[model samples]
Target: MEFDYVIVGGGSAGCVMAARLAENPRLKICLVEAGGSGRQLAIRMPLGVAGTVPAFPFFRFANWAYETEPQAGLNGRRGYQPRGRCLGGSSAINAMLYTRGHPSDYDGWAARGCTGWGWEDVLPWFRFSERNERGTDAYHGFSGVLQVGDQKQPRSMSKAFIAAAREAGYPLNDDFNGRVQEGVGLYQVTQFFDGKKRGERCSVAAAYLHPRLDWPNLHVITHAHATRILFENSRATGLEFRRNGTNRIVKARAEVILCAGVFGSPQLLKLSGIGPADELSRHGIPVLSNVPQVGENLQDHVDFVMNFRTSSTESVGYGFRGGWRLATEAVKWWRTGEGLCATPAAEAGGFLKSHPELDVPDLQLHFTVGIVDDHSRKFHPGYGYSAHVCVLRPHSRGSVMLGSADAADAPRIDPRFLSDERDALTLIRGAEILQTIMRASTMAPYDKGEIHGQDRMRGAELMDAIRSRADTIYHPVGTCRMGSDAVSVVDPMLRLRGAENVRIVDASVMPSLIGGNTNAPTVMIAEKIAGEMKYNL
Candidate 1:
């Protein structure tokens, strides 16, 4: 098969690229996904996330479910890394929180040799990709493909969380994506609020791909596992993939874009002989570009949760009462599109400084009206709630390496979470801050004491708790970093450094981790790249 563009991984970025590039009738685009059909009913339903994303059966099936190599930083524990396998990618199975990250995050990238990635330059791309229910302003767009809206109706515990944060001296800011982000309020979700898809999870496939499926120029191929990029003399010309137990090759007339995300992108690059010289030589693969930075600089937000028992049955948890309530709430979601099912476990959060002297908020807090143990693997009986605290920008970095030469094997992932002493200290302090909010007057009514750690576990013991329990908050980036530096994998234009007709537009290209959720920023990257490609073509 041949096409003008062969986009690998029909995730967040590929969906947008296919939709945008297909606007030109003469251009042909093919989007390939290694997972199942993206039209799962559970994936579209907001409440189904509890089952699809957290539960073991569906979680492993819907996600790549890649675990990191044992890390010395976390007392030799392997971190869980789950990437979305379906068409929308992680956006389909995620919490659906729509965060554009701090404006300064992009500015910091630009300051660090990533030209045209400053806040002002990327803000328009964000605005252009959003169709916020709150209406358009200088910061948002109304006619965009992606749906951004407020939560249908926050649970009572979620409202209490906001009040508790305010009682703890934090301000109440309704819009985190607006002028300022340092406050506590309900999170806006990437959920549709209009037309036939009202109240559904607005995944990238639903927002971009599904809506444009009728376009003759676009072809979406599912269950196509891309094994390697077919290169000819340092130029990416096509891709070799496996589908239904058969090997297939497809040529790219123009470009081969890897939207396979942080892990998959770097893994594919290295598998195709494009990584460090030493690693490729060890694997016995002929070197192509010898790009040392292909899989380096892995970064993720390491989160530590503080759980507390709650007297109210309003919080999400196990028990006959909670189950019955959830059943009734599910009906309400089906009939009226407003209830617990309509919102995520993380209804509200806050961004604050670990130390008052810090220039920007160093800590990001996620408040859940439920107990989340081991990524919801274990359920606690009765009523309980959790508040997760994580460092906004961790100092530690890790890498992704080839586990084997075989394309079907998972890569060796080492996030090395909290390896840096500074990251551990900041998270330790951040957990203390979360404890303060839980003890505030407003929260005293529901607070039933600690469920995870003890107050006596101070200093060394507390640091031990962080090390023992700290895990990924699910935002991973910086693997295939984009910059103007010599060692950078991708240039500021998002094109591969030494490879021709190849570009990577995904979370992997982020020069650094953003201050908030990565879904919105990832879409912005695709939108900006699509705009550029339109003019270039």
Candidate 2:
């Protein structure tokens, strides 16, 4: 089989590319996904997000479930890194938060030699992809493929958190993606509010791929794990893959674009003999290009959670009583699409600066209405809630390397959490701010005091607690960072530095970590690059 463009990984970016490229009926496109169709009811129901937690069956089925190499900075604990394997990729399992980071983030990228990535350059692409329910504005679009809307019914505790944040002296900015980001408020999600699928998550698969599957030029192949890119003298010609316990090869007539995301994209490049020479030689793979930085400069947002028990059962928790209530909510959601099942656990959050003088917010806070311990692995008996804090622009960097030569083996992921002393200190300050917000007048009624790290733990003890409990908030990028520098793997245009007819269009191409969730930024990257591809063609 052959096509004009072969996209590896039917993820957020891949779906966007497929939908856009398919616009020209003459160009054939095939999107290969490693997982299934991602049509489970748990994936569609907004409140079913809890079912996608670390050890659940739904998570195992639809997620890569990659665990990090023991982080020395975290006192030797392995961090969990779950990437969605199904159609919409991580968007299928993410919190559905629709954040575009800060405008300065893109400006910083442009300043770093990544041309055409400044705030003014990328904002149009962001708006072009968004069909916001809040109506069109300079910052938002109204008639686009992807949907952005406010939560239909947020938890009462979530509203209280917003009030509590305002009481803590932070401004109540209703839109973080608008003029300001330094404030506390409810987050808009990537869910659509069309007259039909109201409150349904507008995953890239639903927004872009599902609606256009009938396009004669678009071919979607699920359960097709890309093993390696078949290159002819540094020019990617096709991809060899494994499907249904059988090996197969599909050629790309014009180009091969990789949208496999941070972990998969770098691993695929290394497997195809396009990474560091020494690493390739060690694995007995013939080297086609010696791009030493293929898997280096890994970055992520590491966070620590402060749990609090509440006497009110309004918080989501498990018990005989909670189970009955969950059943009732499930029925309500099925019937009218309004209940606990209609909202993500993180109903509200904010971006703030740990230091007062910083131009952009350096810390991100997520207020969860439900008690969460180890990504919901450890269940607490009664009602409770949590305040999570993370240093947004961490100074620490890590790498993703080949575990072995085998393509099926998971890549060795080491985020090196808290490697920088400044990151640790910033998180400590963020935690202090979170504590103050939780104790504010708005939360005083439901605040039953700290349940995890008690208020008594001071400087040294507090730092120790943070080091032991800190884990990734699941935003990883920069392995194959885009830049004009010689050491960068991809150029500013996202073309592989040493390979032809091959482009990397995923989070891995991000030169640095953004200050917010990575999903929206990932989509914007695809929207921007897909336009570039069409222009070049």
Candidate 3:
């Protein structure tokens, strides 16, 4: 079969691409996804992050439960990498925080040879795609595809965390996505709210694709695994995929846009012979282009989660009382879309600098209303709260390589977290700040004791404790970075070097890691690319 455009991986970017391009009515677009339809109850409910994010075997229907190679820095433990496998991708499974990172983040991309990616140039696309519930402003849009709003019934513990941070001297910020991205405050979430109560998750599929599913020019195919790109010499002509154990080809009459995310995108590239020469040769595949940086320069935020037992029932936990509370909350949400079920447990967080003298915030913090041990894989008995401190830009870098020639096998991922001394030092300082906030006067009424403390330790012991606990916050980026340099994987227009009719529009194309959540930026990239495509057409 053939279409004007064959977009692979119906994640965040793919949803935006299909929706925008299909608006032309004359242009035919086919979106191929390896997962199921994204119309499940868990995907729409905001609190379903608990089941989808940690991704236990039984509940991982919408999650690609990929694990990393054992890290030498984290006491030789393999880390979990739970990517969203359905249409909306990780946005459906992630904490619903709507952040654009720092404006400097996009400027840094332009400075790195990506011409039109600077903050001033790309902000319009961000504005064009956002439909914030807080009303239109210079920074936020009102009538756009994606919806951003405030939480309906955030737990009291979340406010206490902010109050404690303010009491410890950090200024309170009203909007993290406003003029400045530095300070402590509650985060605005990506939810579809109505008049009064909170709302459901506004995933990319829900915001962009679901609304336009019946559009004549758009076609969505699920359970279709892309095995390789159909290439005629240097041009990406179509895609070879598998469905029900049968191979099929979907020809791209216009172009093949890839939105398979950081790991999936690079893995497909390597599998289709568009990666490092040595890597392709080792995997028994002939190299089509010698792009050595296809899977290089991998970066992620390594977060150290600090847990504390709390006496207050406001914070989340797993017990008889907590279970009963959830039962009532479910009813409340169904009736009015208000209660704990409406909350994305990671309800509050902020951007802050490690040193007072630093220019931009080098650290990001997430305050969870529940104990988040081992990405919530390890469950505790009683109620507690968690504070996560992550290095915004890590000095450590790693690579994604072919584990086998087959596309079915997962790629070998290694982020080499905390390999640099600077990251560990920053986390140690950030941890101290988190501890101070939890122990402050505002939290005294609820604070019981520390579940995992670094209070008594200093220096080496503290370093060891950090090494033992540090893991990725699931913000891996930069594997297929876009730039104008020779070593870069894609060019300024997100086109692959030495290749024709192919482009990337996802976190894989980020030249540098941004300072906050990546979902918003990924959606913006798709908006920018879709605009370019329409303009040129």
Give a tens-digit lDDT track for model 1, residues 424-492: 889999887787787778877888877765533678888888888889989999999999989999999
lDDT of 3 at 272: 88
Sorted on TM-score, highest at the top, how do the candidates line up? 2, 3, 1
Pairs clashing in candidate 1?
none
The Cα local distance difference test for each model comes to 0.87, 0.88, 0.88
Once model 3 is optimally superposed onto the true structure by TM-score, how far is the C-alpha of residue 405 displaced, in angstroms?
Answer: 0.9
Give model 1 RMSD, 1 decimal.
1.4
The clash number for model 2 is: 0
In order of appearance, the predictions have TM-scores of 0.97, 0.98, 0.98
For model 2, the superposed segments whose C-alpha errors exceed 4 Å read none
Lowest lDDT sum, 10 consecutive residues, model 2, at: 449-458
Worst 10 residues of 3 by lDDT: 192-201
Q: What lDDT does model 1 reach?
A: 0.87
- Per-candidate total of colliding backbone pairs: 0, 0, 0
Per-residue lDDT of model 3, residues 44-145, tens digit only: 778888888998676688999899999998889898898999999998899988998899989988988999999999899889999887888899998897
Model 1 regions more than 4 Å off: none
- What is the descending lDDT order? 2, 3, 1
